[model samples]
Target: MRISTSQFYETSSANYQRNFSNVVKTGQQASDNIRVRTAADDPVGAARLLQLQQQSNLIDQYDGNITNVRNSLGTSESTLNGITNILARVKELTISAGSGGYTDADRKADAQELTQLEEQLYSLMNSRDENGKYLFSGSRGDTPPYVRNADGTYTYQGDQSTLSLQVGDMLTMASNESGYSVFEQALNTSRSQTKLTSPLVDDGRVSLSNGQVSGSTQYNDRFRGGEPYTITFTSSTQFKITDAANNDVTLEATGEGKFDPSKPGGVTFRGVEMALDINLSDADKPNADALIAGHTFSLGSKPDEVSGSRSPGNTSSSQITGASISDSTAYNNAFPGGGAVIKFTSASAYEVYAQPMGPDARPVATGTLTGTPATKAKIAGVDFDFSAPPAAGDQFSVKVDNHQTQNILDTISEFRKALELPVDKDLASRQKYQGALQSAIGNLESGANKVAEAISSIGARGAALDVQADTNESLKMANTKTQSSIRDADPAEVLTRLSLQQTMLQASQLAFTKISSLSLFNRL
Candidate 1:
């Protein structure tokens, strides 16, 4: 191992430099705490930390999203609560107005109050979020969900779409309820009385059912879709049905439960399920004491469909005339129905009335229509043969009043109007509303229940958001801990290694100084 002085010095210098570099690197690691500041320190650990960092950022974003969801859902819940409270108050007012002792003046005062309440309801339905977006407007957040029509009635202008937000990796939640579901699609219905009565008497009663649009095989369409119809008793033993407008519907035997006069207690008129219980009455046949001779007749003999056209001379054919039949009423007995229509009984008058049985009838709802309805007015799901004019609250349509629900709003609104019945109109008008108020109450309750359910759904979503937030937070903490384990260096271990490197560097320098001195001067 003989070496020149220059070679010895160069080798010693290289050794010293190597030990000094180790000392610097280890000292830096001890000072910094982390094992890998860059890929050069620990390539695999740095790559893994990068992935974890990205995950942690995503978790933070999800948490932010959860916060927004809570805010939006909380707003929805609060708004729905307000609406429910309003409905409750309306229910209270309706009950108070139904009192028999309430005078006309008193009822008028109630109506004024109700008008204010209706306006309040309108405002509540058109609620907006803090950001000025319509809450119930669904995906169309910028547009107003409800609009007051010219008739003073409200209409839903928003589409039926929900707004959803991503709250977690696999979780998404709906943040808004569509106006249709919250306001327009409430679970209310106008069902025909569970039991119906079909009388053979002139003033006899008959119940009508809301016919299906499908015109199902069980019960087919018997009358026109948009036309008003009448079933009149020509005698104590016979009755016939006539269409007041275009004949778009007809009776067919194809359905399972079509009008079968021959069947016992199973009779229908124009697809309307009729309850027939033939009964004999003392008046059926007057004794000889009262008339020339004793005449006895059966109470019910299902009369065949009257086939004929409108003519002054013919009575067998179905006839629709301006002639008002006995006991004509504004209330249609057959129900369980859609469509909200107002009909003018008199030719183009502002006065509106309901004619379920005949032409002459007392108006059930008395208010101002913005004008005449664009189409025929519907009451209890059947068209009212709309006549133009007379100002009232307004003639409006509720498609939610579809066949399943009938025109429940018409029934309820009419019941409300009846609260302020006029003395001049038929006293029977109040009687009709008085009888129907109970059923209308049931419908209102149903609507309220639907709103409650929707509110509950929103609350549930809020709860889910909380759960996702907690889950993301836990996941984020775990990711941080794992990243720490992979990238963080032990302080004691780093310190020890740094000290050893410094010692090595010091020893290398002293050895190099001694060896270089011997090779040049001491060697001589």
Candidate 2:
């Protein structure tokens, strides 16, 4: 084969250049320790490395989220501990104030101290996290959870929504508790709003007093949901108790619903006790005792809905709005038998009847239109405003609701008011004070129990966060190992390949020089 001198030099030069390029590439791989520098190095391995890298980043982000959740839960738990301590102190002060020897001035001093503790509780309940967000404000981290009202009571401003953070690939954690759950929705077991049914004809001879929940567990089981429980006197010496569905509940306690008013004790049923005083000596045997026999007393019913509607026969532009229960006891008394109707005697004068609107029934309450459109009106204990005045004979009817919960702050505020009041030695004053004190103590205990429950929940969340953090650490370690294996170069293999390529390049250079010099001119 005949070859030109230029062709021979070109082939030799190409061989040396190829060997040198291999040495430089292998050296780069050895220095960097990366096997796949680009897609061309190893297409499938490079794609796998990208996926592993994304997973590693995700794990890092989850670790950060776990830290944030732990901080939030820790702050919340610390704040709740402070609240628990304050509530304990308040309970101690309250119990001490109940001593009969403690004068009004002494009680007032206790109230002043309680006020300070309550303020502290308020501050703690509105705690903030390291990020300057309110801890108990639920989803409304920027807003205060509790606000003091003009009446010196605290109102919950936050909602029931929880703020949750993603802590793992498939797990999310609630970073905060709603104030409503932690403090506002505590149960008031001592609530016993008692009233006589409207059907009882009275000459002010019968009085019910000391109405309270004597057994918390039984009372809660029976009356917590505002279920209507009624006591009806089958006779002057006996009464039958029935539930909302009118099923005889007294039968469960005693086979026969029997009571002797002549006995020293009052009527007791299902953890509730109330003193029923009847002037038996003054009783008009056939008439007064007969009224007592048919009389019904409803206990512990709550206001669920307060609304009004205009009568279809009404010829006026009158409409009622903002109807609500101002006093639950009065509302229950007003509608023990049924609903109430507002009948206009004139453009400005109105009468309220406890029964449905009818000509024969007498009015139970009366009110005068004060505004041009008669803006303000109240019936029994329900308050409502009117948009316009009704013409003569126009009527409106109000309905009752049976659902409500007293918040923790309201319970504390009520106790504060009772402590601040000065009670005389009179029987009525002393009895009233005793009742208020008893109710306040029961409610405070309920609030304390609720706070404890919240603390326990926070602790559980903290434990869960700890577990997630450890899991994330394990996952991070595993992911790092996987990434290194898929994308990193073996140091020994790269260095050996680089050495071999360098030696080959040197041999190619020496051979090319020898051959190039020995062309036809040099050989001749």
Best by lDDT: 2
lDDT of 1 by residue, 1-524 (tens): 77776787788888888998888778877877778788987889989999999999989888887877788888888888987887788788778877778777877787777666666767777889989999988788888876554333444557678988777889888878887676666533333222222332323223222321222232223333423444433332344444556342333313322332333443343333433423324574443123211122112212111111121232222222111112224323433122223333332332333212123555544332232443233333233332333222332232222323312233345555656666334444444554445545656676687789889898888778878888998999899899989988899998889888888998998887776565345557
What TM-score number comes out for model 1? Answer: 0.62
lDDT string, candidate 2, 1-524, tens digits: 98888899899989988998898889888888888878899999889989888988888888888888888888888888888888888889889988968998998899898888878887888888888988887888888887774446555656678988888999999988898787767766555666678465654444455455667677667655435777777666667778878777776433357655555446566776666665565546556557567767786633356667776678977788678778879766765334567888998788887643334788777879776556787666767888776789988766543322455667777888888887855555655677678777777887888889988998888888889889988988998898789788899989888889999999999998887778567667
Q: Model 1: how far is 133 from its true place, Å?
A: 0.9
lDDT of each: 0.55, 0.74
Instruction: For each candidate, give its TM-score against the true structure.
Output: 0.62, 0.73
After TM-score superposition, the amount by which residue 478's alpha carbon in candidate 2 deviates from its true location, in angstroms, is 0.7
Provide the lowest-lDDT 10-residue window in model 1.
Answer: 300-309
Q: What residue runs in model 2 are displaced by over 4 Å at the alpha carbon?
A: 196-249, 252-268, 271-297, 304-383, 386-404
Error of 1 at 210 (Å): 8.9
In angstroms, how far off is 79's CA in candidate 1? 1.0
Lowest lDDT 10-mer window, candidate 2? 398-407
